[model samples]
Target: MNTTLQQAFGNIDIYLFDQLLKGRFDSCRNVLDAGCGGGRNLLYFLQNGFEVYGVDLHEQAIQNVQHLAQQLAPQLPPDYFQVAPVEDMPFPDNTFDLVICSAVLHFARDEAHFDAMVRSLWRVLAPGGYLLARLASTIGIEDRVESLGRGRYYLPDGSERYLVDEQTLLSYTQELGGELFEPIKTTNVQNLRCMTTWCAQKL
Candidate 1:
């Protein structure tokens, strides 16, 4: 990758990059990264004049993101990046035009924890806003994952993750009064693991 491109988008999720190419968030102003880690997914948003906010459970991660934000968007207040958990964000309801939870939901310890985190993300999104997420799932390699009970699974990749399926995502979309902005797509990595992209728009 070219240095300029790398600087513009620092290791951003490729699926999220696809949304940018489609101008899915062109009208968005306020953006929140629910589980931002060193703001890897935030460089483009910050440099492009988006009002960016981020939260992470790790204090050091928040500090790192704040530092990155300072370098990329000095005008933003330091409080824009905070130390918090996805299940309990500090922002008000319907606060952001775009809420990103990439590669984060799969860390849920169980079904309840996952539901709490999902609801919290949804609660902060404005009506008609977008929620973009990429998380591990048992989509194409169901048989390759061993159930640990309560939505947790041990996968062939030698890791444990709380995996969701197509039906689970669809159910949440319906229950949250959201619509799928893009059909759920999953990438199976050599039968070791799978990651699914879930893009939805709040109604």
Candidate 2:
């Protein structure tokens, strides 16, 4: 990704995460940025006063996170970064107050992978913690761009995403214990296409 695209994605993600973050977490405690790319979201969490742990499948993201943390806040060390998959996070169970899996789950190659990813996130989140996740849905404007081969769709990375709908999300919530569902909106498009955000909390 070029600087321009990276900036745009970063801005969009920050906006989305910020909206869901508000009023949900009362304290700046332990949080996990599952699939946190380059540790950027972890930086946001830290800047906002959260003790953050970043995990990603790619070694580069983990390395970038370490370097970024060293440069941005050298005082916060040791318990911060790891290279791991969302489906099988390396940390112990109930490790974080919040688990963030942004723009990553949709890349899962199948439903099992997606379900496992969600379950793993839920397992790590402490009671009252939340999963602030964003994905490419089939119900947003981006789907059109992606269908035409121009948008940021999770395809090349062995990722398979479903253009999820409201009922599907609701059903998933019901199937899993300890969660509430709140979907987020995107920029208005003539037709609702791919891309959506949702926040789920552990009860």
Per-candidate TM-score against the hidden true structure: 0.98, 0.76
Q: Write the per-residue lDDT of candidate 2 for residues 1-203, one digit (tens) a residue.
A: 67854443344365445654565565638878888788666655555556778888888888887887776567667457887888898888877887777888767666677778888888888877777887766654434434322222443333445545555566776676655546554433345434566777777
Pairs of residues clashing in candidate 1? none
The segments of candidate 1 whose C-alpha lies over 4 angstroms from its true place after superposition are: none
Cα lDDT of model 1 by residue, 84-142, tens digit: 89999999999899999998999999999999999999999999999999999999998
RMSD of every prediction: 0.8, 6.0
Clashing pairs for model 2 are: 107-159, 137-194, 137-195, 138-163, 139-193, 140-193, 140-194
Return the number of clashes found in candidate 1.
0
lDDT of each: 0.96, 0.67
**What's the true lDDT of residue 59 in model 1?**
94
